[model samples]
Target: MSTESHNAENTGSNDSVVETSNLAGSGDFLIVCEHASNYIPPAYKNLGLDETVLKSHVAWDPGALAVAQALSKALDAPLVEQKLSRLIYDCNRPPEAENAMPAQSEIFTIPGNCNLSQADRDVRTKTVYFPFREALATCLDHLQARGKSPVVITVHSFTPVYKGVKRDVEIGFLHDQDDIFAKELIKTFAAETDKFVLRLNEPYGPADGVTHTLTEHALPRNLRNVMLEIRNDLISDQESQQDMATILAQAILQAEKTLGKHKNHTAPTTKPIKTGN
Candidate 1:
């Protein structure tokens, strides 16, 4: 059964901004999808965006949640997701980051985000970001208390093209400070005969402040972690999302074997890093 935490209210309907699922999962993974929803509460006035724009990548990662749920089912892993549009407050970003509540995204300007006083931004943070953060922290603490050093796997999708430039990378494995898991995943994908167009960090990287969740929740605790960025077009449909989820779940399972519950958390000897976006 799934459990939800609600905050935003619209037209007398209870809307949840954070959700947790499969908490009693028997697997050793925690699946996170920060950009899971595009549902904007009436509070921001759609962040002053058009309907089409609100449904675009800037609002949320289209198929990321589908894939994340698939992965959770495939691996019997626990999952957590945010249900509000990232334009409100990107859960993946700390409140201090500029893009946490972006004033502009791509060529489109965010009128609601512009000229915001600290109090205005803080309201969004309190409403959306903090609850999600606490939920994740509680999940991790519970798992650790149960003697499970769960692997942190965050799923996301990047637009195939950005600013009119077509991206060549089909999958990107990103890591923050911890590189062993990402390197192993790269190796696994590289060995695949199908040969996916992959990279270490393609559309984004730690330098871009995309690793805030990883650093905030995983790094300090010394957990194996990797952020998977799939090209949105690849997983645009349910079948494709499941296919990609199957592929990722297998890779993660294999990578876990290589690490073998490394209580010491030592990096396994692996090939040289060559694959990149």
Candidate 2:
């Protein structure tokens, strides 16, 4: 479903409506971003935090949504994104996980999420989280039904400083017990002319048991997929975002050539799927 109007507060002139939109493409790829916004609707009232806390990483990944938007336009792929704060309901995490509704994200207390009962959690999950995920699944299904099983690429951005230490790796790939797509993409990216010093999984890895939407949908179908994490500093603005998109787009094209097409139903006879770092 196309989201026309967004009642979110003004963060900047570039801020656009944060809802799921499908930019249908003839290419064999589908892109999505689960934690796309830091916007808290008027109803929530800043999650009862001070200005500093509201602007923290707890509110959202600093620049992920921007990268996803640029990548979607560059690659002409269908894009899906969440409309609320990850602290409200982490679309990337399983609903039952303890950290799903974190009381403290890194170092900020989510005062608005102090003690949510099962019913309270259920309300947000049913209302916001499920719809966002459904939108992604629907878009993928639409393509698959048309004899095109698109490669899934989940985009995200990470903070440069997590408590004071600086994170140098500009890109990371996260995958659970599977690395068919992640490994190939990482290798392809490293060897490209761009020569991205991509991290295998520097910031975070799938073994953290942080169940992302990619794991929920793409992996089960055995579809080629990868979770990309770029350092937030690299995508804090349009110029940076576009550069990252170009770098990623090249890597994706290389993966398509090396891994082969998605049309063939047979599974690849590669090395056993291993968990990425």
Candidate 3:
């Protein structure tokens, strides 16, 4: 699903910059993976990074696409994903975001992103950002046109250790302005007999500008949304990815029932979920 397209006019779901699939799935949910690929298109000269850095989480969320695809299949929901390295254009970020094309990520310096003019940024906005946004919007519009309001779910993965600091949070549930969906999700994980370090807004939160996708799509449409940030080490293989997706899918489906209470837009209390054993 590595995509490469330079034309801003290529805004369709079939566009090379983004990928949209599982359209035949139900409307209960719409899943998106913004940092799905690590492809640099052989152009940017690997963003002036080494092979290892390009393959690192700084380039993309390792094993996130697998989990997202599994969720899409399990929920029978449509999924959208960006197909280029985040170093080229972070689909989850707004065009004005500084890290949208970060010159440095963690400790690795992105030489390719350094010293970019406004024109260079504009080119990437048109080529990468627009296509991903349009694709997700198209999915939402399709569901809306069918008179179906689906909960928007975004999938992502974080490095186990970041900038030399070890992260104890195994899984993080983030919300935009809405906390109804997030509350139930965290509750489900906490209620489960199995132990997992699932918490609310750890490592990165809406305050860190990581909820841009949810704000842009779900908030405007008034859809229930939550972003899942899993530890990449937990999903390094197909078996682990599927296993994690199954547990998450069960929790997500069960949590959807709580949405009924919030139809009146009643904001409930957000109780913290204990994590990090």
TM-score of 3: 0.89
Give the better candidate number (2 or 3) by TM-score: 3
- Candidates ranked, most accurate by TM-score first: 1, 3, 2
lDDT for model 1, please. Answer: 0.85
lDDT of 3 by residue, 6-78 (tens): 3344234343667888876764899999999888765567877889888889899999999999999899899
lDDT of each model, Cα atoms only? 0.85, 0.71, 0.82
**What TM-score goes with each of the models?**
0.93, 0.86, 0.89
lDDT-based ranking: 1, 3, 2
lDDT of 3 at 214: 84
Give me the candidate number with maximum TM-score: 1
Per-residue accuracy of model 2 over 1-277 as CA lDDT, tens digit each: 2433222233233333345565456667888777777776666678788877667676777777777777677677777787677877777887787677777788677888888889878876665666666676777788788788677888887788887888877788866655677888888787775545577756777656553776777766667787888888777788888877887888888888898876653334444344444
**Candidate no. 2 TM-score:** 0.86
Expressed as tens digits, the lDDT of each residue in 126-190 for candidate 1 is 87888899999988887888888888999999998899999998899998677989889878766
How many clashes show up in model 1? 1
> Where does candidate 1 have its weakest 10-residue lDDT segment?
267-276
Identify the superior model by lDDT, candidate 1 or candidate 2. Answer: 1
1 versus 3: better TM-score goes to: 1
The residue ranges of model 2 lying beyond 4 angstroms of the native Cα positions read: 1-18, 193-196, 265-277
Q: Pick out the ten consecutive residues of candidate 3 with the lowest summed lDDT.
A: 1-10
